[model samples]
Target: MSKKKEALLAQYAGHITEKFSETPNMAFLDKVVTGLGPAIYNRDAALVSGSDESELETVKANFLIKKLGLEDGPHLMHAIKEVIREYGASERNKYRAVVYYILARRFNKEGIYK
Candidate 1:
């Protein structure tokens, strides 16, 4: 993984630990991050390291929709691209942070992360 992704993951781990302060489920958080982290890392790495941009976006869109359980549409596509640009344009490492944030928020709302 890239240094940037490593840093973001560390930061998120701290936040997760703090968020679960009463119970302090670092084990669960660790499991979640470790289990899901590599895929996010590799996808972003491919986006940055690979040559085909359009193909990557298509693949990324598919992955995001499937992983996020979101509907496939132009709006979701625009939102994905917008989030990427909003967080940090061309910064693959930061992209995972946003993706994780989205996923975490969804899980939290579903009472899975809490």
Candidate 2:
């Protein structure tokens, strides 16, 4: 990864730490994101590559409905959809999608959900 990619992921990792109050190493986070199961795991590469809106949306649903096993489950995944809707309305869909994408990856990496 380039220095810039490293910096972005680092900043994103910090955001996750603040939200969850758990410290996960940057390197570990990267590994897990890259190794994520397919479906919602478009982010494994998207994180450093490019932030595609369509891919991010699928990534979001995949993480929630697939990887995290939140499929149709309530709480977190539902809440994330709400944000996705807002981002769409505000025309920030791409950025917010990636943000949520990063959070989902972080959650999986830290094994956050019960």
Q: Report clashes for each candidate as comma-separated counts.
A: 0, 0
Best by lDDT: 2
lDDT per residue as tens, model 1, 1-114 = 568656755665654344322332444444445545556556554232223467446535655455455566666556544445444544434434334454445334223433
Prediction RMSDs, each to the true structure: 7.3, 7.0
lDDT by residue (tens digit), candidate 2, 1-114: 657556655754664565445575676566544444232225454442123456545655765556656546456544565444433443421333244445565355346432
Q: Alpha-carbon error at 78 in model 2, in Å?
A: 4.5
Kindly report which residue stretches of model 1 are placed more than 4 angstroms away from their true locations once superposed.
1-8, 12-32, 37-62, 90-92, 95-97, 103-114
Pairs in steric clash, model 2? none
Q: For model 2, how many clashes? A: 0
Error of 2 at 90 (Å): 15
For residue 3, model 2's alpha carbon misses the true position, in angstroms, by 1.4
Whole-model Cα lDDT per candidate?
A: 0.47, 0.48
TM-scores, all candidates, are 0.45, 0.41
